[model samples]
Target: MVEAKTHLATKPRWLTPVLFSTTIFLSASLLFFVQPLFTKIVLPHVGGAPAVWTTAMLFFQTVLIGGYLYAHLITRYLSVRAQIALHLTLWALALFFLPLAVSAGWSYDAEQSTAGQTLLLFAAGVGLPFAVLSANAPLIQTWYARTGGYSADDPYFLYGASNLGSLIALLGFPLVAEPLFGATQIGWGWTVGFWALGALLLASGLMARGRHVRTVAQTQTQSAPSLKTRLLWALIAFVPSSMMLAVTTKLTTDIGSVPLIWVIPLALFLLTFVMVFTNRPVASMATLRLGYLIGLGVLAVVFSNLLGIHVSVWSAVLTVVAFFLTALYAHALLYSERPSAEHLTTFYVTMSVGGAFGGFFNSIIAPSLFNELHEGAITVAVAAILLLIRAVRPSRTALFGALALVVVILAKTTLISTFGIFVFGAIAIVLFLAVATTIRHTEHALAWVIVGFLVAGQVFVNHGTPLLRDRSFFGTHKIVEQDGLRIYGNGTTTHGAQRIVDLTADRPEPQLYYHRNGPMAQVLTSAKADASGTVGIVGLGIGALACYGQPHQDWHFYEIDALVSDIAHDPSHFTFMSRCAPDAPTHLGDARMVLAEQDGLSFDILVIDAYSSDSVPVHLTTVEAFEIYLEHLNDDGVLVFHISNRYYDISRPLGRLAETLGLEARIQDYTGNTAADPGDVGSRVVVLSRHSEGLGDLNADPRWTPLASDGGRVWTDDFANVLEVLNR
Candidate 1:
C-alpha cells in the first residue's frame, strides 16, 4: 500500500518504532492500571460488594468503545494534522482531571442505590482520563502507519506491544503499586505517568507528520471490507470480551472479591491479545485448537459443582487456563482477519463495539435476567461452536458441536434425577445427536437449529434443576438439597447448610457454621443477650443465626447486599428468619458503612460472618473494621468472627487486632464426629471480649482456648496483604 521505507546508512530504523510503541504501550498500561486503582478506591464505600468491579468493567468498556469511535471518525474524515491537533487538545483537556480520586464523603445510604453510586464515583473521579487514554492505541497506530517507517505497512505489531504493556500493568499493580502505596498516593503516581504518556504521544505526533498517503494505490489494489466482514469482526470480539468478565465473576464468586483476583483473568485476557497480535503468536492455530478442546473439558468440570458433584479447587485454576487459551484462539482469529492499515480505526471500532456488548451482557444484563450464572456456560458453549467453525471444516464443526453438547449434557446428568436433571440431560444429548446427524445428511440447511436446540435444552435443564436459585448484584445464591441436608451455595462452594429432620432437640436446628456442636452455638449459649441487650450481626446468610436469638433480645442484622437480605428473610428460601425472628429488622449496605452510622455499644454481641462462599470482603476484616465492631458492642459484649476460608487464614490477623486493643480472645476450632448430621458441619470462631469474667460459662469453660497470638500483624484500612495468607 505504501513504499516500504528503507532507512539510509545513517538513520536508525528502530528509533521511530520505539517512540510510537512507547506511546501506545504507556497509554494501554495506564488505562488498565487505573481501572483497578479507581475500583479499589470505590470498593469500601460500596460495602466491598463483588458487583462493584463487574459494573465498573461495564462502564470502562463503554468508555473504551466511545474512544475507539472517536478515533475512527477523526481518522476517516480529518487530515493528518487536524487529527493530531484534536487528539492533543483532548489530551490537554483530560489533564484538567488529573490525580484521579473518588470524591470524598460519598457512601451508600438507605436512600443510596449501589449501581448509580458506583457510576457517580467513576464519573467524578476517572471517567475523562480513562476515555482519553483509551483513544491512544488506535490513533497512535494510525499515526505510525503514516510515518513512512519500516514497520508502517504492518503497524498491527504495535497493537501487541500495547497489550503487553496492559498485561504487565495489570499483573504488577496488585503485586507492587497497591502494596507499596495508599490510594491517594497511587493516584498521584498515575497522574505523573499519564502526563509522561501525553508527552510521548506529542513526540509521536511530531514524528508522524505527513502531507501525502498512497490513497490511489490502496484503492486500486486493496479491497475494503464488506459489511458482512465488519459484523463478523464484531461477533468474534464479543465472545471473549464477554467471557472474560463472566469468568472473572466466576473467579471472584469462588475466591474473595479482592483486586488481585479481579486482575488475573483480565491480565490473561490482555496477554492473549499480546500473543495473537504479535508478528509471531504465542499460541498457533494448532495450539489454540488443542487448548480449546481442553478448555471445553474444563468448562465441564466447572458445571459439576452446579450439578451437586464435588469440585476440586483445581477446577477453578483449569477454568482460568481454559479462558486464557480460548481467548488466545479468538484474538488470533481476529489478527488473521485484520484489514489493511487504511481500515485500521474502523476495524478497532467494530471490535470495541463487540467488546462493549459482551461487557454489558455479562456485567449488567445477565445478573438481572438469569437467576444463576448460565452466562458462563452459555459463553463457553457458543465459543466452542463458533471456534469449532473456524478451527475445522463444516462436517467437523457440527461433529465437535455435537460432542461438546453431549459433554455438557453428561455433566448436567451427573445430578441424574429420575424425571428432572437426568431426563433433561438425556433429551439434550439426543437432540444434539439429531442436529449433528441432520447437518451431515441435509447439507447445512439447519445449522442454526443447533443453537435453538442447545439453548432450549439449557433452559429446561435449568428449570428442572433442584436448587432454589436467586440472582443478586453480589452473586448467585442457591439453596440446594441432597439427602436430608440443605446447603447454601455462593458460586460452587457451600457457605452454610441445614438438616431437614432435626437431629438436635431444638425445633430450629443450627447447621454448618451454626450447628449445636459448632462454635457459634457454643458462643450463643455463652454470650446470651439480656432482656434489653441488642445483638448485632454482620452478613446475613439464610438468616441462620436467628435460631439462636434470645427472646426480646432486640436483634438487628447489618447486611451489605439487599438481595441476600431478601433471600434470607423470604420463607421460601429459608425459614430461619421467618420462624425464629420474624420482626428482626435488617440494616442494608456495607456492614462498615451501616455500623459507622450507629451509636457505640448499640449491641451486646457483634458476630462477623461476612466471609461466605469464599468472598472475603477485605475491608470488613481490617483493623479499622474490628474497632468499629468493638465500638458497637456493650462494655462486656462478645465479638465473634467467623474466620473459616479456603485460602485466607484470617485468624492470625484477627487475633493480632484483639491483642492490640488488650482484649481477651478465644478461638474454638470445632470438628464434629463422623456420626454427626452432615448439615452440622464444623467451623472456627474467634471470640473477643473486654470482660471474659462476665462472659457467663464461656469464662470457666475448659474447651475454650486462648488465642495463640499472631505474629504482631494486622490489615489496616490503608494496608492489606491478602496474598501473604495463602493456605500454601
Candidate 2:
C-alpha cells in the first residue's frame, strides 16, 4: 500500500513537463491555424487584395502585443490559483464566440478605410479566441517556473516547444488541412483543438499545486532587468517580425497572393523561434559567422531588378534560406542576451512589442510613406548593417571561409537581363572590396559593397519614370511609355499595353489583348448585334476593352484598384477610355462586392480583363463570383474572362468552376504574329455563358473549344487551393 502511494505521489514529477508542454503546444497550434483559415474565408470580401493579408498581419501583431501585456501583468500580480481561475474564466468567455469563424456581416469595402475596417473585422472574427490562446505559453511557463520541477530551471524550453507546434500547424494547414478539408470543417477542428488546450491548461495548474518549491534560477535572480535591456529585446524582436511581413509581401507582389506563400514565410518565422529559444540554441554564435556574411548577398539578389521577372525556383530557395539564416543570427544574439527566468513574461512582452512595431511599420506605415515596397530591401539592409556593426574578432579561417564563398558567388555570371548587375555595378563593388582588403576593415567593406549595390541598383535600374508611377496597398504600378506604347506595369509583369499611335481613322486600335481579330473582339462584335446595349466589365486595365464600346451602347466598369481606375481613365496615360467610352459609368470596388449590389440582367456582355499582372484575382474565379456575373448579365449576355497568366495554370480552376456553375465555356489564345508590333503580345481569354446562343459568333470558330471544369476541382467561397493550379 505504501509503494502504490509513493508511486502516486511521484507522478507529479513526470506530469509537470507533459502538463506545461502540451498546454503550450496546443495553444500555439490553434493560435496560428486560425490565421490562414480565417483569412481565406474573408479574402473574397476584399477581392483577395494582397493588402488584405498585410493589413490583417498588422492587426494580428498588434493584438499579440496586447495579449502579452495582459500576461505580463497577470504574472506580476496574480497568485497561482487566481491566475488559473482568471485564465480559465477567460477561456470560458472566449468559447461563447466559438466555432471561430468570420461573420459574413463583418466586411470591408474599397471606399471605407481598409485598415480601420479590416482591423474591426479581424477583431470581431478571431480576436477573443486568439487572445485567450496567445497568453497561454508565456503564462503557463511563468506558473511552471514558480513551482518546483527538474525542467523548471528553464521553462523557456516550453516556449520553444510552443513555436514547434506553431510551425507544424502553419505548414500543415496549407499542405494537409486545406487540400483535404473545407473551411467550416477546419474552423470546427480548431475549436476542438482549443477546448483540448483549455483542458490541458487546467491539468497543468492542478499538477503545480505546491508553493514551497521554486526553480533555483528564478529564486536566485529576482532583480528586474534594466530598461535598456528590455528595450533592446524589443528591437531585436522587431526586425524579424517586420521582415516577416516584408518578405511575405515581396513574394506575393511577385507571385500571387495565396495561402501557400503566406505559410512559407510564417513557417520560417516560427522555425527561427523554435531553433533559437530551445534549451540549447541551434543558431549558435559560431554558425552566425557564415550566416551573417551570406545575408548581404541574399538582400542584394532579393531587391535588385536583375531577377525581377524571371525569379526562378533556385532564386526563391535562396531567398527562403537567406530569410531564415538572417533571422537565426539575430535570434542567436537575442538568446544570448535573454534576461533571467524571474523576468520571463517581461521579456516576452517587450519582444512582442518589437514584433508588433515591425509589422505595423511594414504593413501600415511603409505603404503610406513610400511609393514602393521599400520595406523588404530596407529591412535586409538594416539587418546587414546591424550584423556588421556587431562583427566578432574572427579567426583567419572564418575570414577566409567568408571570402571563399564571395568568390564562388561572384563567379556565377548571366546575361544583362539575367543577373547583369555584375557588369554595370561590379566596378563599384570590386573597388570597395579592394579598399577594404587594403585597409583593416575587410568584413565591413565586403558587407558595405553588397548593401550599397542592392540599394543603388534598385534606384538606377528600377526607378526609371516609366511615364506614370503609382503605389497602393495592393502593389507598385509603373507606367512606362515604350515604342509609342503606354504599358501598365505591376512590378515585372505588364498588366496592360496599348499603342499611343492610332491605327485607324477614328478609333485607337486595341493592339494587345483586344486586337481586332482576337477572341475578345470576336465575341464583343457578335454581342453588338444591337447597335445599343449594356456592357459590363470586371477589370478596367487602361480600358482596353472599352475600344469595342459603341456610341449607342451604355458601358459600365467595376475596378477593384482605384489607382488602376484613375490611370485607365486618364487621357494622358491611355486614349482608349477617352476615345471609346468617354462617359461610361465606373464603379470602384471589388467585382464580387460591387456587382453583387447591382440590379439583375442589366448587361449584354461582361468582360473580365482584371488579372493583376500574372496573378489571377482568385475570388473572382469561384462559383459564387461567376454566379454574380450571370446575375448582372442579360438573358443572352456573354461572360468574358482574360485568363492570361505566366505563373498560374488558371485553365484548370476556371474550367472546374465553370463546370460547377453549369455554364458553357470556351477558351482562345491569341498568338501574336512575329511581324507584328512588340506591343502586340500573345494573350489567352475564356468566355462563358448560360446558353450556346449567348456566346455569339466565337463558338463558330474552331479555336473556341470547350473548357473542362472538374466538379472536384471547383473553387468556392469556403475552399480554394492555389497550389492545385501552379504552372510548374
Candidate 3:
C-alpha cells in the first residue's frame, strides 16, 4: 500500500479532478440538452400545451431516479473492474438508440391520456441514452471517491462542475444551439459528444482501478446514516424540484411554450445546485435565510395581485427571481445536510427519489386534485414550513399581533372597495412590516405569518368563485359570470363571453375576439360569398365562431381540448354551438394532426385561431404546417391567422412564411374602443392567399395593408427562435 501510494503521488496533481470533472460535465450537458430538444420535437404532436413540458419533466425525473439507483447498486455490490465493464457496456448499448429522433411508428392518440402518451414517446425515443448519461454524475463521483487521491476524501465538489455543465447546456440551447442547428444536426452532434464521453469514462475508470479495493474497506468502516437523515435529504430536495416545474408552467402558460421559456427556470435550478455544492458558497446562511423570506413575500404579493400590477414582463421577472432565491436557499440547506463521501451514491439516490416525487406530484397529482394552478402557492407554503423548522420560537406579542392583522385583512371586504385598492395595499404592507420587524430574530414567526398570508390570499384574492371550473392535461378552464356576461377563461386569457340576457335570444352575437367589429368578424365577412362552401376553424372556444357560420355553409371545428368542446356544446354554459351550428362536427385532437388525417378534404376558407391562453402554438405557424394548410385550401380560398399576442410579434414570422412561399399576404391591426363594447378589444389578424384576386373586394379596403416581413425568419418544424421576435 505504501509503494502504491508513492507511485500514485508521482503523477500530476490536477489530472484526476480534471479527468473526472470533464467526464461528468459532458454527461450532464448531454443529459440536460436532450431534455428540451427532444421535448421540442414531440411538442407539436402533443398539441403544444404547456403541460407537455411538465409531463416530460416527470418522465425525465423518474428516469433519473433509476439512474441514481443503478449507480448506488453497482458501486456497493460490484468490484471496480466489474462496474466499469458493466457501465461501458450500457453506454455502448445506448449508442444504437442515439442520434435521437421520434420513431416513425409513434403518433399521438386521443383515446389515451396525453401524459401517458408523452411518457411513452420519451421512453421510446431518448430513454436509454438519457438513463445511461444520468448515471455518469454519481457513478463518476463514486469512482473519484475511491481513487485514493488527495481530494478523494471529499468528492462532492465535482457535483458543482457537473451542474455547471448542465447550466451551460440549458443556456446555450435557446441562445446558440436552437438558432444555429436543426434537430438532425443537434442529434448528430450529441451522438459525437456521447462518443467523446465514453472515451473519457474509460480513461477515468482505469485511473481509479488500483485503489478501489483499499477504499472499499475504508468506506466500510464509516458509520451508515439514519433513516431520518435520508428522509431529510429527500424533503429538502423536493421543494425546489417541484418549484422549478411550477414556475415553468406559470411562465409558459402566458408566454409561448417554446424552448426558451422552458430552459430559463431549469437553468436557474441547476445554477443553484452549482452555487451551493461548492466549497465556498456565494451567499452565507444568514443572507440566504433573509433573501428567501423576502422572496416569499414578493411571490405572495404577486400571486395575490394585491397591488394590481399587470405588467407581464415585470411580473415574470419577479416570479423567476423569487424562484431563484427560494431554490438557492433550499439547496444550500440540502448541501449542509449531505452525508460523507463514503455514502455519496446513497445520498444522490435519495435526492433523486425526492425529485421524482416532486415531478410526480406536480404533473400527475396536482392537476387532478386542484381546480386552479395552486401548485405554486402550495409549494411555497411547504418550503417555508420546512426551511424554518429550526427557528427559535416567537414572543407572544408578535404572534398575537400577526393573527390580529390576518383577521383584519380577511374581514376587509367592503373596507377595500370603499377606501380603494391602493390604500388597502399600502395599509396591508405597513401591517406586515410592523409584525415582521417585531419577530426579526425568530424566523418561525415570520414563516407562520407568510403562511397565513398565502392561505388568506389564496382564499380571498386573485380568483373568483367561477360558475364552473375544469382542469385537464391541457390547462385550467373557468366559466365565470361577471359584469352581466358569462365568460370562458383559460389560464389568464379570456376565450369567449356572452351577455347573460342573450341566452334566450336566437343567434346571439359572438363576443370577445369574435365580436362584430373585431378582425375575426371582418375575415368571416370577406368570405361571405363562399359561405355555401366548406369552412374549417381550428380552435373551438365556446364555439364563438360558430355563430358567424352561414346556414348553408359546411362548418367544421377542430379543438385539442375535449373539456373546451364539452363547455362549448353545453347550452347552460354557452349556447353558440347549439343555436348557431348545432350540427357542426368538432374534432378532439391537435389541429395539425387531425388535419393531416383528412385525405380528400378541402375548405373554401380556413381559420387558424388555436391558442393556449395568449400563446399561439408554434407548430401551427411552421413552414411545414402552412404547407398542410395550403394543401387543404381551394385556389381562391384564404387562410386567416389570429396572431394577437401580448408578448410576441407572431405576425412577422407569418409574413416571412408568406414571402418564402411567394403567397399574397395582408394584415389588419384592429383596435376598437372597449368602452363602447367590452368584448371589442384589439386584435391583429393576418390573411394569406395564393393569388391577389383571392382576397375579394375587402382586400381593396384601407383597413387591410400588406404584411411587413422585415427581420423575420421563416420558421420550420426543424428550427424556430422565439427570442428574435419578442415584442421589445
Candidate 4:
C-alpha cells in the first residue's frame, strides 16, 4: 500500500482517495438523476417529441460547461479550505429554491420555437443545480489532490468511480425507482437525498484544510492542445453519443408512445462505462465494440424502410446493446487519455466542451446538414481518427496509402455505376503522382484534403436530396407529406399530422394501429350516442380519431407541442382535424391542468393517448392518473385506453387497477388486423365502466372479455410492476 504523506485523523493512505471517489460517485449519480427526472416533469408540458430530449441534452451540456468553468476558477483562485467553504455556501444558498422542484406554472407556447422554450425553461428551473453538480468531478478531484493528500495520478481513478455512479442513477430510475414510486414520491426522496449530500459537503469542508498538502506551485500551462488531438477527442466522444441519441429517436418514432423505453438505451450506455472502467478491459472494449458495430450494421438493414418492420421492443433491446458498447469504447478512451492530476480541471473542462459540441452537431447541425442521421458513417470515421491519434509513430507512407484507398472506395460507393471507371482512373493517377513526387509534407497536406472532402461530401449528399428532416430544440423530425396528407415522424413512429387525401382515391390508405378503429375511436363513436357529449383526446396524432365524431358531440384536443398541431392543422397533410372537427375545441396545454379547471365540464368518454413515439406514457398509467381520468369522465361514462404494444403486456396493470377501483373492465385483443379495414384490425382495448349498463354493453360485444385476476396486484400511484406483465 502507498504510504500517507502526512496522515491526520488517522485516515489510511487508501481511505482519502476511496472516500473522495465515492463522494464524487454519489454526486454524479444524483446529478444524472436530474436530467431524466427534470425532462419527465416537463414532458407533460412539452409535446412528447424526440426534439424535447435533444433540447434538454443541449441545455445539460451547456450547464456542464459552466460548472467546469466554475471548478477551474475554484482551483485556480481559492485554496483547498476556501474552495470547500465556497461550495458549502453555494449548497446552502441553493436550498432557498428547494424542495428542488421546478415551478409548475411554466407555460408552453407552440408558436415559439421548441429549442427556445426548452432553454428558457431550463434556465429558470434547475440551471443552478445542474451547474453546481457538473463541477463535482473536476472540483472534488482537485480537492483530493490538495487536501486529501493523494498522488496526482490517484485523482483520475476517481473519474471511473464517478461514471459508475452515473450509470447506476441512469439505470435505476426507470428500472427501479419510477416503477416502484410515483414521480411525486421520487421528487420528495431526491429532495431528502440532496439535503443529506449537502451535509456531507459540509463535513468534507471541515476536514479540507486540517492538514497541509505537499506545497508545489503547479503554475498555468495554457498551451493549446494539438489540432489533431482536439479533433480526435471530439470525434471519439461525439460518435457513440450521437448514435445513442439516434437510436433513442428511432425507438420512440417507430414504436408507440411508452416512456420507459427511453431508459433502455440510457441504461445500456451506462453499462458500457461500467464494463470498460472495471478491471475487465477485454469484456469492455474488444468484444463489446465488435458486437456493437455488427449490431448497428444489422439495424440499418432491418429498419431502413421505416414502414415495413415494427421491431419496437426487440430492436429497442438491440439498439441498447449497440449504443452501450459504442459509448463504452468512446468514454473509455476519454478515461485512458485523461490529463495528469495537476491538469484535472482543464481535462474535464475540455471533455465538457467536446460533449457540448457533440450535442450541438447531432441535435442542431445534422438534421439541417444531412438527409439521414449518418450515425454509422460518422462512427466509423471517428473510430479511425481515434486509432490514428493513439498510434505513437504514425507512418506517412502507410497513412497516404490508406487515405488513397478510402477515397477510392467512397467515390465508388457514391457514384459506382455512373462514373466508376473514370473515378478509379483518377484515383490511380493521383497515387502514381504521389509515388513519383518527392515533395516534403505531401502526406500531411493530402490528409487535410481527404478530411475536408469527407466532411463536404457528407454535407453535399444531404443537400442534393430532399430528405424530409426537421430540427427542433430536442431532436430531428422527419416529414412525409404525400397524397395531400402529411405524416410527421421523429425517428420511426408517426407522431402527428392531418389527413388531406380523398378517402375514395385509389391509393394506399393509412391504416393499422393508427386507424380510427382503435380505443380512441371507440370512445369518439360511443360518445356520439349522447347528444352534446364532450370528448377529450390527449394525443393528437394526425387527428385520425376526429373523423369518428358527430356534429352534436363537442371534441377538444389537448396537445403540448405546436409543431405537431401545426402539421395536424394543415389541410395538405392529414385533414382529419380540419375536415372533421374544424370548429371543435383545441386546448393548448397539459391535459391534466386544463381539464382540472373545467369543473362540471365532464366528458362522456375520456381517452389517454400520450405516447413516446411508440411507448406508454407511465404518468397516465398510474392510479392517481386514473382518478384524474375518472374525474373528467361523467358518471356512467366509459373510459377507453389504447393498450396496443409490440413488447410487454400492459393488460395486467390496467386489469389490476380496474379490479381495485370497483370499475368493471374488459380487454379486447385485436392482434392481426390491417389499416384498409381499420375496424377489423387486432388491438387490445382496456375498457372501463362504472355503470353496470355500460359494462353490460361492452361485455355484450363478444370481442370484450372480463379481465381475469388470478394473482394480479393493483397498480396504485405508490407502486406498479411492468416486468411482471411482459407477456411471460
Candidate 5:
C-alpha cells in the first residue's frame, strides 16, 4: 500500500496539458467562427462582392499583428502573474462589445472606398474580441513553455492544437453551424463560447500560479534571434498568407461567394499549420517535385485558359490542390526554421507581421496596381520562383544550357498563340531544368528564368488587348472585340455583347442572354402591348435590355459597381447602353438596398439580371428580398430572374421561394445558334407574377414550363445554404 501510494503521487497530472490545450482550442474556435459569421452579415451591405472577403482578411491579419505584438511585449517584459492579469483584464473588457453585430447606421456608399469602409465596420463590430482571441495561441503556448510540464520545453505542438481548433471551427461553421443556425444565433453562441474560454484561461493561470514566473537574469542569458533569421521567418510566412487570399478570390469569383467556398481555402490553410506544427510527416522531396509539376499545370490552365477550363469542378479542385501543396511547403519551411521556446512570442510576432503585409499587398496594393485580377497568377509565379530558389542548384555549364534552351523556346514561341501547346511545353522545360539542375547554388538564375517565362506567357497568350480593362470593389471588368462582336466580360463569364456591325443601326439588337430570340426578349415582347409603365433592371450589364424599352416607357438601371456603370456609359467600349438607353438613370448600390429605399416607385416589369460571372449574390434571391421586390411591383407586375449559370441550379430555390409566396411562375430555357451568331448564346429565365394573366402568352407557351420547387429549402436573409443548389 505504501509503494502504490508513492507511485501514484509521482505520476504526472494529465490535467495541465489538457487544460491549456482546451483553452487554446476554445479561443481559436471563437476567433475563426466569428470571421465567416460577421463577414456573412456584412456581405449584403457591401453588394455581396467577393472582394469583401479579401478586405476582411486584411483587417483580420492586421489585428492579428496587433495581438501578437501585445503577446510578445508582455511575455518579454512582464512577470507571469502580470501577463495573466493583463490578459484576463482584456478578456473581461472584450465582453462589453459582445453579441457581435454590425452597426445599424453603417451602409456602403459607391463613391467611398470599399476596403476602408469594410475595415471600419469590422473594427467597430468584432475587432477587440478578435484581437483578444488572437493573442491566446502565442500567449498560452508561452505560458505552457514556462510551466515545465510535459512537452513544455517544446511548446510549439500547442500551436497544432490551436490550429486544429481553428480548422474545426472553420469547417464546422459552413457545414454545421451556418446551415443550422442563423447569423444572430451564431453570434450569441460565440459569445457564450468566449465566456467559457475565459473561465478556462483563469483556471490555466491559477494552475500555473508562481510556477511560470521567469527571472530577469534567466531571460538575459537566453540568446535572441538575429535580424536575418527574423526576416526569413516573415518571408516564409508571407508566401502562404498571400497565396491563401489570392486563391480564395479566384474560387469565390468563379463559384458563388458563399461561406462554403470561403471556408475551404482557409480550412486548408489552418490544416497545413496543424500538420507542420504537430510533427506530422511532411511531403518528401519527390512529392514536392510532383507538386511543382502540378503547380505548372495550374499555371498553364490559368494563364492560357487551356482546354477552356474555366470555373468547373475539376478546375477548382486542381487550384485547391496547388494551393494546399504550396502552403504546406512554405509552412514546413517555417516550422523547420522555428526559434526555441524562449523566443516564441518574438517568432510569432514576426510571422504575424509577414501575414499582415501579405494581406495588405493582396487587398490594397494588387488591386490598385493591376487592371485585371492578376494577383492569383502573380502569387502563383512568386510561389514557383520561391520553390525553384529553394530546390534548384546548377553548374555553370547547366546554367548556360538552360539559358540557351530558353532562347530557343522564346524564338519558337514568339507567336505564342499559333504554337498552341508549345507555350506550355516551353514553360515545363524551363521549370524542369530549374528542378533537375545540380550544383552548389543557382537560385537567382532559376528565378529570373521562371519570371522571364511567366512574363512572356502573360504578354503573348492574349490574342488581342482589351479596349478597356477596369477593376472595382465588385470585380474586374473587361471589354474586348471578338468574332465581329464587342463583349463585356466579368471574370470568366460574359456579361453582355453587341454586334460591331450594328453600330450604324438606330437601336442595336440586345445580345448574349438578351438576344431577341431568348427568354428575355420573349418576356419583354409579350408584355410590351400593355407595359407602358416603369421598367426597372437590377443589373446594368452594358444595359443590354435597354433596347426593349418603348418611348412611352421609363427605364431605370440598378448597378452595384460604379466601374461597370462607367464602362456601360462609355460608347467606345460598347454602344448598347449609350445608343439604347442614353437617358435612363442608373442607381449605384446593391439592388436589394436601393430597391427597398425607392419610396413609392413601382415597375410594370422588374428584371433581376445581376448575376456576375457564375457567382450568385444570395441576398437578392432570399424570401425577404422577394417581398421587397413585391412591394415595388404593380399588383399584376411581372418579375423576371435571369438564372443563366454554369455552376449552380438556383432555379429550384427561386421556385421554392415562389411557392412559399404563392406566386405563379414559368421558366424558359432558350437555346440559340451561337455557332452562327456569337451574340445569340443560350439563356434560362424564370418569370413570376402574383396572377397567371400577368405572364401573358408565356403562361400558355409550350416552351415555358411551370417552375418546379422540388422541395428545396427556402433561402432567407437570415439563412442560406449554397451547397443545396450547387450543380453537381
Candidate 6:
C-alpha cells in the first residue's frame, strides 16, 4: 500500500506498487502480443519474407525513441494529474481504431522488398499503440516520484520488474496467446487491458488529490548532464541492446532459425541486464572480464571455422552458448554503468539509439555495407571495446599490451583462415597478462588495439563477398556453390539452388526443390495423370512446383513470401516459371488464407512444403490447416507434407492429426543412410487421404507404412499443444 505524502492521501501502502507492477506487466505483455499477431495478419500481404522481422524491428526501435522522448517532455511540462489525464485522453483516442486489425485491401506483389514493406505496414498498424506502450515504464516511475512515493534507488528495481513483464510477454505470447486466441480476441484483450490501465490511473489520481506533494530529489535537481555523458550513456545502452538483436539475427539466419533458437541469446541478454541492475554482485568485474575473454575466443574460433565442417546440431548448441555468455558479459557492463533515475529517460533514449544502430547495422545497413551477418563479429568487437571502457584500475597498461599482441597476431595470420583461431587464443593470453600487469594505461591501449584489429580483420573477411551472401530481416540467405551447384540457403534449409551445368547457358539449372526428383515432381506427375484435376501447393518455396506443370492442369501456388517468388522468377537466376509453366497462377500470401478463399476449387494433390526445413510453420501443422487441405482436395486427392528436421520428430504430430481426422496417412522416407542411421533421417513425406481407396493405393507402395499416433491432442488454428509433442 502506497499512501501519498500530502494531507489528502488515501491510497493504501500496497496500491502504488501493485498498480505499477500491473501497469508494467499488462502493458508489456499486450505490446508484445501485438507484434506476432499483427505480423501474422499482414504476413500474407508481405509474403512471409525473412527480412520482415528486421523491418518491423527498425520501426519498433525508432518509435520507442519517440515514446521515451514524449515521456520526458510530458514529465517536464505537466503536473501529475495533468499527465494522467492527458494519457487517458490519448488512450481513448487510440481506441477509435480498436480491435487491432490491419487495413483491408492491402496488396503485396512478388517484386517488393519484404523488409521495407513489413516496416511500412507494421508502422502503420501500431505506431500509436507502440508509442503509448513504450512510455508506460518511464511515466509510471516518474509518477511514483512526483507523488513522493519512492526513493531514487527504487525506480531501477521497478524497471527490472517491468522487463520481467516484457520477458513474460515475449515467452507467453508465442506459447499461449497465439495458440489460444485469434487475432480479434487478442486485439480485444489488449483493448480491455488498456482500459484497465486507464482505470488504475484514475484511481491513483483520485487517491492523490490532497496528498502533500513534496518535491522529489529528481524533481529538485535541475542540473543537466553534460553532452558527453548523455552521448556515452546512450552509446553504452544502445549499442549492446541493438547488438543483442544483431547477434540473434546471426545465430538464427547464419546458424539456424529452429524454434527456441532465438530464445537462447535473448534470454541471456535479458538475464545479463537483470544481474547488472539487481542489488547483487553476480556481475563482478572479474567474472565479466573472464567471460569476455572466453566468449571472444570462442566466437573467433566459431567464425573462422565457418566452412571447416557443416553446421550441425552440436555446433548450434555451442553457438547459442557462446552468444549467450558473450552477450551477458556485454549487457551486464551496460547495467553496471546505468544512469541515475533523474537521467533515466535520457538513458533509455540513448539505449534506444544504440539499439537502433545495432539493428540498422544488422537489418538495414549490413546487407549493403558488408556481405554476411558481420553484425555478430562486429558486435563481438564492440563488446570488447565496451568491456574495456568500464575498466578503472591498473589494467589499462595491460590493455595496450593485449591490443598490440592481437594486432601482431592478426597481421601474421591474415593469410590463413584457421590462423584466426590461434589469434583468438593468443589474444586471451594477452588479456590474462593485462589482468596481471596491474597497469591501467597499458590495459586501455591494448583493449583499443584488440578491438580495432578484431573489427578490421572482420571487415577484411566481409570485403570480397566470399564469406557472406545477402542478409535480410528474416535471415541470412547464403550462396554456397558445390560441384557446380549454386545453393541459396536460409538457416540450414536449402531454399533455392541452381546448378551451373551449362557454363555457356544464361540461366542456371534448377536444383534442390526444383530438381526432377523432388516432392513437386510427384505432385506434377499425379496432376498430369488427370488433366482436368486441379493442383494446389500449400507452401510456395520459390514456386518450384510450377516447373512440373502442364498447360491443361489448373496449377495454383500458395506462397507466403513474395520475396521468394521474386528470387525464383528472376530471369537472372533459374527461370522455373518461364521454362516450365509460363502462365502459372501464383497466389501471394499465407497458404491457409488462400486455401480458405477458394471454397469450390478441388485439387488432385495438395503439396504442403511451407517454411524452411529448420522451422515448421506451426499454422500449417494445425488440424484446421489440415482440414483446409482436405476440403480443397478431390475425394482421391493426396496431401503431401514435407517433414524434414535435423532435431525434432514431427512425424508423431502428423500421425496424430491423421488418426484424429480418421484419415489414413503414409510416410515416405526419402533419405536413407547405409553407413549408419545417424538418427538424422531427412524428409518424412506424410501422404494423407480421406478416402480408403486412396489409402489402399498408397499402401500398395512398398515404401508406405501404416502411420501410428497416440491420438492425444489435435492442434487447431486457435489452439495447439506442442508441449505434448515437442522433442525434449
lDDT of 3 by residue, 137-183 (tens): 88998899877665687789999999999999999888999988887
TM-score for each prediction?
A: 0.87, 0.93, 0.93, 0.77, 0.92, 0.80
User: Superposing every Cα of model 3 onto the true structure, what RMSD results?
Assistant: 3.9
Task: Report the poorest 10 consecutive residues by lDDT, candidate 4.
Answer: 300-309
TM-score of 4: 0.77
Report lDDT (Cα) of residue 10, candidate 2: 70
- TM-score (C-alpha) between model 5 and the true structure: 0.92
Clash number for each model: 0, 3, 0, 35, 0, 39
Scored by lDDT, model 1 comes in at 0.74
Error of 6 at 9 (Å): 9.0
User: How are the candidates ranked when ordered by TM-score, highest leading?
Assistant: 3, 2, 5, 1, 6, 4
Top model number, lDDT: 3
lDDT-wise, the better of 1 and 4 is 1
**Which candidate, 1 or 2, has the higher TM-score?**
2
lDDT of 1 by residue, 52-167 (tens): 78889988998999999998888778876787788888888888887775566766765566776777788887888898889888988888887767668878999999999999
Clashes of 3: 0
RMSD of 1: 4.6
lDDT accuracy of residue 31 in candidate 3? 93
Per residue, candidate 4 scores C-alpha lDDT tens digits across 315-412 of 45654554565577677776666555666777777777877876776667766676555543454444434443432112455444544543443344
Q: Which stretches of candidate 4 lie over 4 Å from their true place?
A: 1-11, 47-50, 119-125, 147-150, 202-211, 216-232, 254-260, 267-314, 364-491, 494-532, 671-680, 708-724
lDDT of each: 0.74, 0.75, 0.82, 0.61, 0.79, 0.61
Question: Root-mean-square deviation of each candidate, in angstroms?
Answer: 4.6, 3.0, 3.9, 6.8, 4.5, 5.8
Candidate 2 or 5, higher TM-score?
2
The positional error of residue 115 in candidate 5, measured at the CA in angstroms, is: 1.5
Deviation (Å) of 318 in candidate 2: 1.8
Question: What lDDT score is found at residue 644 in candidate 4?
Answer: 67
Q: What is the lDDT, from 0 to 100, of the residue 466 in candidate 3? A: 80
Candidate 4 Cα deviation (angstroms), residue 218: 5.4
